[model samples]
Target: MPNNKDLPVSPFSPLTIGPLTLRNRFIKSATNEGSAPGGVPSKRLVQFHESMAAGGTGMTTLAYCAVSPDGRTLPNQIVLDRDTQPHLRVLTDAVHRQGAAASAQITHGGCFTFLKPQQAPRPLSSSSGFNKVGLMSGMLRKQAMSEADIQQIADDFVRGARLAREAGFDAVELHMGHGYLLSQFVSPLYNKRRDQYGGNLENRLRFPSLVLRRVLDAVGKDLAVVCKYSITEGARGGHTAEDGAAIAQILEREGAHLLVLSAGMNVESITTMFGSSFPKENRVSSNNPIMAAAMFIQSLTAPKVDFRELYLLEHARKVRAAVKMPLAYLGGAKSLQSIEQVLGEGFDAVTMGRVLIAEPDYVNKLEAGTSRDSICTSCNRCVAMMYTPGGTSCVLGQPGDAQLNAQPAALI
Candidate 1:
């Protein structure tokens, strides 16, 4: 257990992040809720975030809001656009009513998508290569992004941020981590380009930096612009801890309001990011059999990492020393003790996913001193729930709960 002594600030303290101020330092990190159907936020999705707000989180993030239609990792993922702004507004308003700020995580899947050619012909990525995840959907390969593709995606990020502001989001978290489009560009393991956008750290960062600058220019005044990126890609030849710190410094220079420091890649080193081995029972709930099979096969060889409290603290501290911008630590924070320890370590805030999913009101319990630790066992069943018809939920909760059993939305 972390000694809670000599902490500079409590997790309950308010934090200012550029244009927005959180009521407390605890933020519910982005977790794809799989509730959006037809690329629009559903009523359940609104209620999902509302629960987090009411439970006492300073802010709750709507996860994986793709910047463009073709950018979605799944057909049902929400897309931030004119057509969905009203639905998103409803979500943000609900969070505001509970006195918690709302954040939209704007992202592009890049080559990580499962869309077929008929749906997303020529899916673009940093460099063209065989796409293992896309193989199940017949999207066997990805196209190396051309100059026009790069500019168009950057424009899409601007539009997404603009729409997020229109939707009443207090912030827009640009997802540059988790082996997504931006992450692909940053990792040498994925980016093998010989053009100006490749070959070195500065070149790899060029595209993501462009996207961040464009979004900040468009909505930095209206909403806090948070950039979440991996501090380490967690693979042998991928971005290292030093590269992560350099990325943080560059982002600070680029004017990101806050940095959410994370690690690992969804494609190459997911367990390293989450600090847990893949659960064997994870195959039962997927709506897509092909994806289920892929996950199962991957699990067989997925690197095993024992779950530990504050898993990313060491790497995050390096980033903290490299940049003066406010930093949010994400990964393995499950208790008030851990949260306090992270804050004491100089992080401006702590972002949690599994604990929040396990108990939406966990923060409230901590503030009241009613609970010192979360009941989450880190079984990772909730991770599997992300692909379920009902979206992510704690298996420890009662089965067949209506909110956890919402009818599956038809895939676009």
Candidate 2:
């Protein structure tokens, strides 16, 4: 039998982050499952993470749990609050029963939401500007956040973290990337304010830093506080790799227990994050005629980048060199060799999204020597399918798969 005894570190090795210790170094990166319909955790969502835990992942992160109702990118997105706490507890208990830790990725959408005009009027962002992403929903403009708004949002994050702790989550990942509310404050392209919250890199990081500090103060001792941020905005005028390293350092100083290194802004350079374009035919369709037409037009102009293994390694390496905090490398990690390489290079963990979606038992298979790499094609079809009523599923999955057939609650 082949032995991993001589390997510097095995992917199955335990890893410590703050007060928590994971069974292994493989983390299921937060992927929007869309199983939470009407902002409540569904049975499908519980089964989803339960499968990952039973399959041998160290931890699985639930994606984009909005800190407040207005933070939702979509109406059906899960919100961390009292009403949902019981449901979230059930989900977390299911994960714990399988012997794996669960994490909640708390975030806010900012100007990237499709909320109806009557519901939001004007979405809040770092600076007032046209909201191209929300134009189809008649949300044409975004409002710059006031000082009170910033403080309120920070408090919301703290409340969310505390709720996650009460709900039994082992960690809370603060989403400060992907052009969301916090990323809006971090990115120069979105944060154009003349005040202390804008201008230089330090100023742009002000609000995000504030949010991080507050959340840590509230729940840092109870749950591992992981901060996921873009190492680069993946666009010409956005934050670069150097800026990402600085951001990592600042986050580390603010008491982030782990830093998840990611890249690309969902608004302008999403392909940079996924490492490929959404297949034209697989572009998410809308029920609204005007929105559907707008989506079709946008599909024609969407940027494309060829997929590659370990696509974010270069950027991650830059951040790794700058901070002493535990780092989790995200993006394009599919093979056992790739995970081993990342850990060897000093990353504390490897986070996988698409691959896990394709094969929830992938880590178990690797440990059993039944597989060397994930069977996932990284086609990103699952990205589009996330908006479907049944939520994300591998197109290659055989018929009758539970995840492929789950009926989630309807969105309001």
Top of the candidates by TM-score:
1
- lDDT string for model 2 (317-374, tens) is 9998999899999989999889889988989999999998899999999999999989
Question: Tens digit of lDDT per residue, candidate 1, span 39-103?
Answer: 76776787789999999999999999998888888888888877887778878888999999999
The lowest-lDDT stretch of 10 consecutive residues in candidate 1 is 403-412
Candidate 2's TM-score reads: 0.93
Every model's TM-score: 0.94, 0.93
Error of 1 at 379 (Å): 1.0
Show pairs that collide, candidate 1.
none
Against the hidden true structure, what lDDT does model 2 obtain? 0.86
Alpha-carbon RMSD to native, per candidate: 3.5, 3.5
